[model samples]
Target chain A: MAAEIKAPAYRQFSIAPAIQPGSMADTKTFVANEKIQEAIGFPPALVDDWHDRAIAKMGELLSKYRSFKVYMDACVHCGACSDKCHYFIGTADPKNMPVARQDLMRSVYRRYFTIPGKLFPKLVGARDLTREVLDEWYNYFHQCSECRRCSVFCPYGIDTAEITMAAREILNSIGYGQKYSNEIIGKVHKIGNNLGLPGPALTDTLEGLEEDVKEATGIDVRFPIDVKGAEVLLITPSADFFAEPHIDSLIGYAKVFHAAGISWTLSSKASEAGNFGMFIGNYQQLREIAMRVREAALDLGVKRVVVGECGHAWRVAYSFWNTLTGVGSGAADPYAMQLQKQLDHRYKQPMHICEVTWDLIERKVIRLDKEANDKHIITYHDSCNVARGSGMGDVFGGQFDIPRNIIRAAANNYVEMAEGTTREQTFCCGGGGGLLTDDLLDLRVKGALPRMEALHNVTETHGVNFMATICAICKAQFTKVLPYYGFDRRTVGGVHQLVSNAIRLGDK
Target chain B: MTMTTLFAALFYLAALLFSVGLIYRIRDYARTPAPLVIPTTPAPRTVGGVAMRMAREVFFFESLFKGNLWTWAFGWLFHVGLALVLLRHLRYFIDPVWDWVIFIQPFGIYAGLVMVAGLAGLWARRIFVDRVRFISTPSDHLMLALIIAIALSGLFMKFVSHTDVIAVKNFFIGLLHFNLQALPSDGILYAHLSMIATLMIIFPFSKLLHAPGLFFSPSRNQADNSRDKRHLSAWAAKLESGK
Candidate 1:
């Protein structure tokens, strides 16, 4: 009877990472390994021969820093950092211990690199670096969301996330890397976006959405796709184009635009705002993607670029965007990164989608009809990458509150998840760090159980039928996991979706 | 030569080594910079719960009280009793009499009892617990043995032997003020002094340095609210402007 319940189909399409630039050809050649690599192309790595290259690169990178030497010198394995983890605290899994989690990488790193290990070996739990160890590194290191939460509690401030990131980079250098990240990087290199669906495809998607809006409301909404003189270039997750929940967000964006009578365009060149390289410690690729998006904005003559609901996408946009371009590249200011750096002193422009949404409501440009979204009981899921990751928790807290306010304006009841899942203590959707597309479903499901459990608690108690989120990937993950955990799909939608449903479509 | 003078000479030399060594080591630490220190949650200054945090630390050992309650309980007891014993020993340094030191003697003996019990509990915990045993290096076990030995020897002089503490006090006082002194004729007291010297030399290099460090610890000392705000420390500001 249990076997009759079909193993839930893992949703791979909507949340897959952007692939690498020069990695697809290598993925094509291998036989059995190729099948595994192709099965989850989001986390693309070199097939069979990748291990040799990884080992060589590990030596070169390890030799460059005294920090790794210090890291090797430290670590008493007191296990002080184990139970402090939210996952371990929530799950009570023994292997989720931070010291134990890090031992997977540290043991291999010691065997191949350190002196005592190369000499005595057995005294320090060090072992010979082998293909098996590399396999372990691939499995375990990717499990970390690179959240930096564990480091907060560690007495030594020893960041296991930093070690995992370094390990991922070492793997990437050897051609063992994520396919989706590589693909997106390749797109950034070639067409200035991760979505590989280039300028014309983006325009077509926008134009089609325009027609959808026209049919729904009888309002002639023009989604300006790369209009040269536009004041704002609105960018968002690639998932919003075809994905169910975020499409409603796009409609909300259109309605807001119509009411404000503001000139904005979806950049034909840089349609997708997410940069997955930020997750894998490939700072160069991260910078390159940001550069292309900024270049598109500059070339098309938009004064500002507003990013959408993705978390790490906003992090890269806010944190690294300015530093990597302009003076870092010795080029003229690209507008977006420059605006962020001098938020107080720069041009009186630059805004995120959430900010713009609140501004439209504040200006009384868009009048929302209160009865449209009154049927379902909804609650907000704060994206870690959005709230804390991008250093916009306060800003997005207010912004996220605006969406819930709009929902409450439509309906009297909106709820919050458990204690630690809001404001300063929000949890990451298990699919963060391009792990959403990696072939680690068992790990992802187990890791995401906390979030699913929290959501389930809300549903059982408050009859929360609607799970409203801002990020596109959050929408995609919920759509896939909610049903497996027994929550209906009709309950999940973007913040903009609620806004679109409630806002009067035409002249009120 | 007078026996008292010999005692003073020996006492002065030991005191010189301890005071100078402690100060030198502390100075070195003060000069060294700790560049990164990430603060954790519910730090003393930041907890918003209705209960006072210090009350929790004193009563519950809130932060020190961890998932492994038995080990943590022993650790907390050991630390509290050890701190009191050290304070009681301060009587040796003062000349004439500080009324408070004499007042605290009975409390000191009680604290010693707690320390002995806590040390035994911790030693047993290290031996019996599976995960603790697995991660316990030989050095870890050896360090515990050294601490237990020191604590027990001190406890013996206090409760069992009842050695001539007057002579010991005189020796320590002469040493603190730089009068060289000979050992008290009691061999057990000499053994206690020797054990204490060994512990002092080892203290700087061992995990026992956590005693002084726990106070400076960014996790424990600083406010957690600083992370959300752009907190510019004076030193940080000076460095930035200098750059």
Candidate 2:
């Protein structure tokens, strides 16, 4: 299936392609089946009255989220963001343009809600919510990674990600959830993680990782789990247990803990830090998923919570975890206030693992032999969610600088990708926002064109051999699509993977 | 009714619709709940920082400057020129026009030309740019056409077929006091005033709401201090309170 889809060729310099209408109109993700939809509390199938239900859902969202209502009204169709989308640049699909993609639902919004669209639909481009429009919403909205790159460029900061999430939420309400995100959300709810690994399997995976690190470095680097009263509760993506590159970062986290002599344990109950409810724009589900972490934190009586390397997971953990579950300060509700009281006030609540590692490196709590990673030349890929959605170290742009600072501290050679493609302006990894399933491999490969081009340039100029990122999805997506573009799949790995290579295991 | 009375009635209706509609829309935006902190990052960490950022966006079109040079240039030119032209029009309503308004009269006359040029550039992109043309609806085009026509008609009155300036000023000043006064019956002047009225009537209904909407955009206006502060909306707080 991957072979059937060709990757976009790497361009010498980045340039937006001319608009090609309907170029990717046929590329749609698989719709969730009844069991998957119902597992996550969505309707089992498309309701007979889906049109009215969808419109009503949209009305509810418009009043609920200011981002939705304001974005729907604020756009002037300036085309500034038309070429900012990677999918548009890669596939040249005009509909892939951020503004055009938004118009899909905005048109429906105007038809039902606005005066001009109601009285003169043709003049304002409003359309009825037909079956065809819903399908189009599914196809194109899923194509977006919810990366927020276009938001940075828009004059009024019109974020299409907000619209996409709201559209997905409305779709799920009308019983039209995507198979990948819905399935995973169900798994996270029921099985404690997206991979659906049971407790015993997770324990076995950790035990195996402990042995692997011990054998490789002749040091006892323990991967502890579910130890009550541990100082820190680490919530990482389950991909860390089940996947390569991700597992290496897992190993890196263990080594860092071993070196620092800190008591940190992973919880089987709240094993995953990611919340797909954010992807679907379901507030109830988002709060529910986050409540597991609150439960685990309260149950274990841990003072601090540290999230591992996952883009959207960090976004949820850093941005929404406070309001949803009181993982941060200033909690007002009963549950949030309880959790907030239990957490240590001195440390950042629900800190990023990079923040943890960087703090250790800065204070010399753990030492990294810079020459230990001499074999690799590294460039950091700023994960979209982390870059644009969250921060670190209590400073603006800390998310950007801290990881690169870690890479520089660990390795001798560190180069950056193109300027525009770094920091807040970074491109999506193509497989973010729940489009990482095998069904959307073609879209994934196409959407990765911009980042791949930037990476290709760094490789030529600086001989950069490895691209390190702090996102589980970016690692997984790049590992899969790198080879399609004639680069080694092994070239992409985690930021801590480099740290793992360089960190001194025993005797500080 | 005479053209004067017809226009007087139209202007009164337009003023009412514009003010009431704009107020209603602004209130709707302000009342809507922002349940989470979703400011695009590298965002300001303080309220003051966010204000500065918003000021830059509103005054300089900072994000648009980051986006595309052509669009930013034309958009900024059009908006800035429109502000000047509107400010200069204060001379019509004020019996004793402010010294600043009098000082800007010449610049305002020239600003009409600049506004139309900017609007023309924006309109050309809508027509010529494939990506833009794909997204442009008939209303988008007609919105531009309407504004450009308004600007051109104003310029026509100023430089080509001049109207009775003192009489126009007296008429508007009289209207401000709710006293009926005969408006200048010049064709270009009537066309210009009618289009301005049309724009005012549609101001709240059309994309022109983007003006006030920009202030309410959470992504642009919110501070990136989510970790330091927990923000919950009234409706979301209800969920937690189990109400």
Candidate 3:
């Protein structure tokens, strides 16, 4: 079965992270290779003066970003966010606390930037920029998913994600990078997808999806790729083309497009939506990755753009795409002006597939046979990047409701997990912010503890045999972590996967 | 210098340090670019809506309320009480005290009590709460100690040993108008004045800058109109346009 990944269990986490001390400090991920670093225009390897270069980069970032400078200074160490992080709650590592994690950079920032720290570093607990501090930054910063859960609770609105991103960016500048995110970014640039799936491979994958849907429902649902003059360019995660349940979501998107009668095609040049550049906080690389979508849209002459099920990709698309490349209208700048003129202005630019699907369901354009999903008791896991960083529909909290509305519409049985753990205050799947690699397996499994505990409540009470989400990373991470917690790996899938099983598609 | 001249010179030095330091610090914060729209979501989409959000955060500690309640209560008490007490201090600087400042003076004493109590509760949390204690540094405790000492000394000068109000008022008014006068050198008053001077001198350099820094926090202040409007920082624009 596709659920079996053929890897040994790193550790079984039946119990959640006990609120003890120092539970997760020793864990680490693989380091990026020279080629991966060079591909993204960073240093090929660590130089002899890496410390000075890192300090210089930190200085550059403090001047260039207001949030970084303000957050570094604004923290009063009040500890409001000490227990807000799911990783901290699950693992109980003291450093996992958001205030402590930000202090890693703040201490250095003070030593270099503030007069008191410059004169009496020890009095303020400020440390000189040294090799040991760099090691600590790599260890703890990667443990953070950049989920921004801590930011929601912080009085000064100090976002540890911003600090973590800056630290990662400096780490990369000095030739220290995570193997997973850097490699994926390089792959996205080189082969148009994170998996390095070639144009011909993508075509074959789409063809296979078309055949699978055709055989299952005996309908001619098309999964077209690189079709010219299409109305919508569907930018989705590359994992959707290969992974088990993610592939199921791809099939679901094809079915929805067929039913809605919208002309859509996946672009060969910009097949991936998950941008790893945002993971490392490198603005140049982030912009370069996002511009691919615009390049694909402009090259293919598409009128509208829609994103598929992916978490951080949606954040980048919803929050940063416009500034990076005028993907949306109303921006007066040349970058936004040029792209806005080309995109058909009648539709919302870069709509979420869930929003589009929800809209169609609302108008009764797509009918769902709820009985088809009766066997599965379903609950939704809010993707962190989507829940905290982006919004959906026209309303403010529409991001939370639209996905549940779609789930409720498509499935017969739906139950929300705890109220505190759902909606805007959701927990990450432990594998977000580009820590979704085999190297960070220990952290990912342990990070999945708090979420699993929340899921346990719904699973036992509601008999929720299935956990549905809209992000590809959440789907993949849960599939990996579920088995570690005695749940079947097959229990996790996408919201669209449920939609695929329930949608009655012949004459919509 | 004589004791009177020394006190006068110190006041002038503190005024210069506070004003110049605050201006430059605020200038740096304003100049730093916010390159992304990262308001924690379900955030407001309009500028006016953003103002309301910040008002709630500053006045009520909205996010902290959602976090730990005890921390919120203490934090709120400290901040609100500090606000009232600071407002009540305007009576000394103005020749004819404003009616509002006079009305607040009664509550100002109570505010001083509340502020000390809140600071005590917070300090206890730092010493007793494991999560808080783990995050608290020596400087964190010292920052609290400095503020609490200020509040207690001010209370002592008010209720325990009184200073000559006329002389104190003349000294502040003279300092305000650049007309030198001998400041009251009462033991309690000296302790209180030096602490106040220390706070003002370190106002821009210390974590106390959070007083103004909160206003410019992009996460709290930025609108959730990322889809409707594009926000390209100068550095980002230069990079994007060239590419």
**Cα lDDT of model 3 by residue, A272-334, tens digit:** 999989999999889888999999898888889999999999999999998888897678876
**Which ranges of candidate 3 are over 4 A from the true structure?**
A1-22
Of the two candidates 1 and 2, the one with more favorable lDDT, higher being better, is 2
List candidate 1 segments past 4 Å from native.
Answer: A1-93, A105-132, A152-158, A178-184, A293-305, A319-351, A359-365, A393-411, A421-423, B1-153, B162-243
Estimate, for each residue in B1-243, the C-alpha lDDT of model 2 and write its tens digit. Answer: 298888889989999999999999999999999999999888999999999999999999999999999999999999999999999999899868799999998999888888998999999999999999999999999999999999998888877888998988877877789888888788888889999999999999989989999999999899887777888888888887782
Ranking by TM-score: 2, 3, 1
Question: How would the docking of model 1 be graded?
Answer: incorrect
lDDT by residue (A44-95, candidate 2, tens digit) is 9899999999999999999899999999998999999998998898899999
Can you write out model 3's per-residue Cα lDDT over B147-220, one digit (the tens) per residue? 99999999988898888988988888988898888877787778788888888898888888887789889889
Give each prediction's DockQ, rounded to 2 decimals: 0.09, 0.87, 0.75
Candidate with better TM-score, 2 vs 3: 2
Per-residue lDDT tens digits for candidate 1, residues B1-243, read 265564454445555665675565455444433222223332322445213543454455554344346656786788789888988988877877688888888899889889878878877765765434545555566666776777777888877888777767777766666665544676666666666666665454444544444433333343432222233323433433342
A80-123 per-residue lDDT for model 1 (tens digits): 55544434433334445566567666666656765445664565
What lDDT does each candidate get? 0.59, 0.91, 0.87
Which stretch of 10 consecutive residues in model 2 chain B shows the poorest summed lDDT?
B234-243
Docking tier of model 2: it is high
By lDDT, rank the candidates, best first. 2, 3, 1
Q: Candidate 2, what DockQ?
A: 0.87
